[model samples]
Target chain A: MLRIEHFTKTYRSKVAVDDLTLHIAPGEICGFIGHNGAGKTTTLKACCGILQFDKGAITVNGHSILTDPIACKRDLAYIPDNPDLYEFLTGIQYLNFVADIYEVSKTDRNQRIAHYGNLLGMTEDLTLKISECSHGMKQKIALIAALIHKPRLILMDEPFVGLDPIASHQLKNVMAQHCAEGGAILFSTHVLEVAEKLCHKIAIIKGGKLVASGTMEDVRGQASLEQVFLDLEDTL
Target chain B: MIRTLVSLRFRALFTGLIVQRQKKNKSSKGTVILFAFLFLYVFAVVAGMMGFTFYSLAQPYHMLGLDWLYFSMAGLMGLGFAVLGSVFTTQNQLYDAKDNPLLLSMPIPPRIILLSRMIPLLAMNLLFGGLVIVPATVVYAIFVEFSIVGLLLQLLCLAGIAVLAQAISCLLGWLLHLLLSKLNKSLASVLYLVVFLGIYFYVYSQAGEILTAIVMESQQIASILSKWVWPLYAMGMGCLENGGLLLAFLGICAVCFAAVYAILSATFLRSATMSSVSRKRQKLNLKTSKTAPPVNAIVGKELRKFLGSPVYLTNLGVGLLMAAALTVAGVIFREDLLSAFSMIPGFTDLIPLLICAVLSFLISTMYISAPSVSLEGKNIWILKSLPVSGKDILNAKLLFHCRMTVPLCGICGFVLALAYG
Candidate 1:
C-alpha cells in the first residue's frame, strides 16, 4: 500500500499543493486529474522522492519516503510527463543499467526484458541508440524500462501524451495486467476519456486542493464523471 | 532588431554562466576576488605602457623605434583574444543549450539565433582585447609625446584590430564545424586534435618572430604593418606621426567593419539552416534478451547509453584514445622526449612516476563514467521509482565510471612502467 498524509508544497508565496491526503491499495489504478499548474506533477514528484515537500509524510509499505528514501524508492517506479532518457544510450543498454541498479537476477532481467520489450514492440530498437528513436519510441522505451524491475507501485505523469493510439492501447492493457497482478498504479493526465475509461478511482484537483476523489461510482453519485468534473471545475 | 537580439543574447549568456556557477557551488566572493586580481594586473600593464610612451616621446629618435613594441603587443593581444574566444564559444555553448528547451523552440530565425549566441563570443573577446590594448596605448601616448588627435587615432586602430581578429576566429570555427560534420567519429577526433596542435605550433612560431622584432627593428614594425593596406594600415596610420594617415586608417576601419558584418550575417543563416536540415529521425527495433546475464544486461544498457550520442561518446571515449595515442607516440618518439627530459635534472628520474600520475589523472578526469544519473535529465524519475535503493542506483553509475577508468589507467601505467624501465 502507498500512503500520502497531509502533503503540502509551497513555491515562495504560492501554495502549489495544499495539505492533501490519499492512499492506494494493491490492485488499484488511480487516475489523477488536474489543470495546468494544479500541482499534479509536484505531488507525484514528492511521492517519488524526486522533489522534497515542505510538509508531508509519504510512505510505501511502511517505509517513510523522507526517513528511508532508498527503501521507499525500492517499492516505486515513476515516469515523468516528458520522458528524457539518456539519448547517448541504446534501449538495451539503458535497460541493463536499470536492471543492475535494481539487482534483478540475470535470468529474471533477461526474461522480463524480453517480455516487456516484445510487448512494447521495442525488441529491434534495443540495439539502436536512443537518440535515433522518435518521441513515441523513446516513450515506449521508458515504459519498458520502468517495468523492468517490477516495483509494487508505479507513479506516472502524462505517460500517454506522445504515444500513438496503438501504443496507448497496449500500455492500457499493461496497466490492467499490472493491477490484476496486485501491483498499484497512480498516474496524472489531462485526457479525460482515458481517465474515465481506464481508472478504477479518480482524483480531481483544482487550485492546489483535491476537489474530489473516490471510485467512479462513489465520486459521481448519479452524474457522469465528465459532468461532475465540469461542475466542480466551474465552481472553482 | 540587432541591438535587442544582442541584449537578449547577453542576458542569456550571463544567466547560463550563473546557472553553471551555481551548480559548481561558486560564491560571489570568488567572483569578486577574480575581478580584483584582474583589475590590479590591468592597471600595472597600462602603467608600464604609459612609462614606455613617455620615454620614447622624450627622445624623437625613439619615436619610430617603439613601433615594433606596439606591433608585438597588438599581435600578442589578438592571439590571446582569439584563443579565449574559441575556447568559450566551442566548449560551453552547445552544452549550455542542452538544458534550455524553450530557446531551441523559439520562432526566431536560426541565423538570428546563432548570431545572438555569438554576441557573447564577441563581447568576451572585446573585453579581453581592451585589457591588453588600453594599457599599452596609454603608455605609448606618454612616451611618444603624440597629440590628442594621435592618441584617439591609436585607440581606434586598436579597436579595429580586435574586431578583425574576433571575426577571423569566428569564421574559422564555423568552417571547422562544417568540415568536421562530414567525418566519422574516430577521424573527427584525430582531425580536431591535429587542427588544435597545428594552431598551437603556428602561434609558438609567430611568438618567436614577434620577440625578435621587438629587439631588432622596433619602429619599422608599425610602418611595415601599416603598409599592408587593410586592418594593419588603420592601426599603423593611426599611430603614425602624420595626421593624414590617421584619417585614412579610420576610413579603412569603417569599411572593414561593414564587410565583417555582411559576411557574418550571410554565413550565420546558412549554418543554422544546415544544422536544422541535418537533424534526421531514425527507425529503431529494440530487442530484449531471452535470458539476461545478471550484470551484463544492465551493463549492456549503460554501454548503449554511452555510445548512443556522439557528443557523450566523444567526450568520454576520446580520453582513452588520446591516452593510447600519446603512449604509442611516446614510445615511437622516445629518443626525442627522453633527450629533452634528460636535460631537466630532477625530471629524468621521476619521468615514470610522472607519466603514471599524469595518465591516471587524465583518464579519470576526462572520461565521465558515472555522470549517468545527472545525464538522465527527466528520466531520473523512472530510475528513482524502480524497485531499487538509491545506493544501488548510485553504485551502478559508479561502476560504469570505474569500468572505463580502471582498465585505461592500468594500461597506461603498465606502458609507462615498461617504457621508463
Candidate 2:
C-alpha cells in the first residue's frame, strides 16, 4: 500500500503538484490519468523516493519515503517512462545487477529471468548490450528488471508506450497476477480504454490538481472512460 | 548557418561549465566567489610562469643574435602547448560528441557544420597559443627594438602559427578516431594512459637539463633545429631580416589549414558519426547469478562503467597508472635516482617520503564520484528508484575510488621505501 498526503512539489516558484493526497490499497491497480505536465509523473516520482516534495509525507508500506527512503524503496519498484538502462551492460547483466540490488538469491533470480525472458521473447537477446536494444526491447528489459525484485508495490510511468500488442497483453496478465498476490500497482497512462479495463481505481488530474478519483465505476458512472476524462478536462 | 552551429556548440559547452551548476545551487554565493577566485589564481600563475621564461630569454637571445632561434622556439612552444591542451577536446567535440544527430539532421550544409565545430576548437588553440606567443613577443618588443616591417612580420607569424597548431591538432584527432575504431576498448585506454604519461613525465623530469643545454649552446642548437623546422626558420627570418620568409611561412600555414578544412568538409560527417564499437550478439546462456548487497552491486556497476569507455577510464584512472609507472621507475633507477637527489642537501634521505606524498596527492585528485554523478545525466532515475539510500549510492562511488586507488598507492609507496632502503 502507498499513501501520499498533502503533497506539494514545485520547480522554482511553479507548482508541479499542489496539495495532492492519494492512497492505493493492497490488491488494487490504480491508473493515474493526466494531461502533459499535470503532475502525474511528479507524484509517481515522489512516491517512489525519486523526488523531494516541498510539503507532506509519502509512505510505502508504512515507511515514509522522505524519512526512511531505503526501507520505503525496498518494498516498491519504479520503471520510468524512458528506460535508460546502463548501455554498456548486457541485458542479462543489467537484470542481474537489479536483482543483486534487491539481494535476490541465485536460484530465484535465475528462475525469474528465465521465466520473464521467455515470456517477453527476450531469451535469445539477453547477451546483447542494452545499447543494442530497440525501444520495445529496452522497455521489456526494464519491466523484467522491475519484476525481478518482487516488490510489494510497482509504480510505472507510461508503461505501455513502446510495447507491442502481445507484450502489452503479457504485461496486463502480469499486473493482474501481481495484484492477485496482494501487490499494488500505480501506473500513469494516456490510454483511457486500457486504464478502464485494467485499473480497479482511477484518478484524473488537471493543472496539478486532482479533479476526480475513486473506483472506476464510481468515477465514470454511465459515461465511457474517455468521455468522462474529456468532460473532466473541459471542466478543468 | 555557421553562426547557428557555433552558438549551439558554445551553448552546449558553456551551459555545463556555468549555467546548470549555478542554477541548481543558486543560494551558494560563497561557492561562486570561491570558484571565481580559484580560476583567476590559476590563470595568474600560468601567465606569470610564461612571462618570467620569456623575459629571461630576451636579453641573452638579443646578445647572441639568435632572434631566429627565439622566434622558432616561441612558435614551436605555442604549437606544442596548443596541441597538448586540445587532444581531449578534439576527441570529445569532433568524434564522440553527443549532439551530432541533433545538429546533422538540420538542413545546414555539412561543411558549415564542420567549420562550426572547428572554430571553437581553433579558438581554444589560439587561447593557449596566446599564452605563449603574447608574453614572448612582448618581451622581445620591450627588450629589443624592431623595424615596422619586422613587427608586422612577427604579428603575422604569430597568427599563422596558431592556425598551424589548430590544423595539426585536428589531423591528430582524426587519426586518433581511426585508431580508436580499430583497437580494443580496454587496451586503447591503457595505451592512451601510457603514451600521455610518458610524454608528460619525460618533459617534466628533463625540463631543467633541456633548459640548461639550450642556454649554453643556443646557436648550434638553433642551427640544427632550423634545418628540421623550416617554417619556424622562415618566421624568424621574416621577423628579423626578410619579409618574404614571413609570407612563405604564412603560405605554408594557410595551405595546411585549407587542406585540413577541405578534408573535414569532405569526410567529417562520416568520421564524426562513425561508431567506435561494433555490436555482435553473443550466444545466450541462462545461468543463475549469486547476489550481493546493493552496495556491492552498485560498485560493480561503477567499475564496469569505468572500464567500458576508454576516454572515461583514462581520464579518471590516469593517476593510478602513473603511480604504477613511477614505482617501476623507482625500482629500476634506484641508484641513478638517489644519486641525482644526492646533489641537493638533506634531500637524499627524504626521497622516498617525497615520492609517496606526491603520489598520494595525485591519487587523491582522481575522484570519479563528482563526474560520475553528472555522467548519470538523464538516467539518474535508476539510482533514485533503487532500493538504496542516497548515502549507499555515494558510498558505492567512493568504494570504486578506494578500490582503484588504495592498493596501487600502497604498492607504489612500498616500492619506493623498499628501493630507498
How high is the CA lDDT of each candidate model? 0.69, 0.85
> Candidate 1's residue-wise lDDT over B46-157, tens digit each?
5565445334433343454556335344535554655454653643442234423555467765556555666676666666566566656665555555567656766665
| Candidate 1, Cα interface RMSD | 5.3
**DockQ winner among the candidates?**
2
**DockQ per candidate, 2 decimals:** 0.41, 0.71
True contacts kept of 1: 0.46
What TM-score did chain B of candidate 1 earn? 0.67
Candidate 1: where are CA atoms >4 Å away? A8-19, A52-57, A61-75, A103-128, A132-134, A233-236, B19-69, B72-80, B87-120, B142-147, B183-210, B213-230, B241-270, B276-383, B393-421
Segments of candidate 2 deviating more than 4 angstroms: A132-134, A164-166, B21-37, B146-149, B184-190, B215-228, B309-312, B340-363, B366-379, B391-398
User: What lDDT is reached at residue B309 by model 1?
Assistant: 48
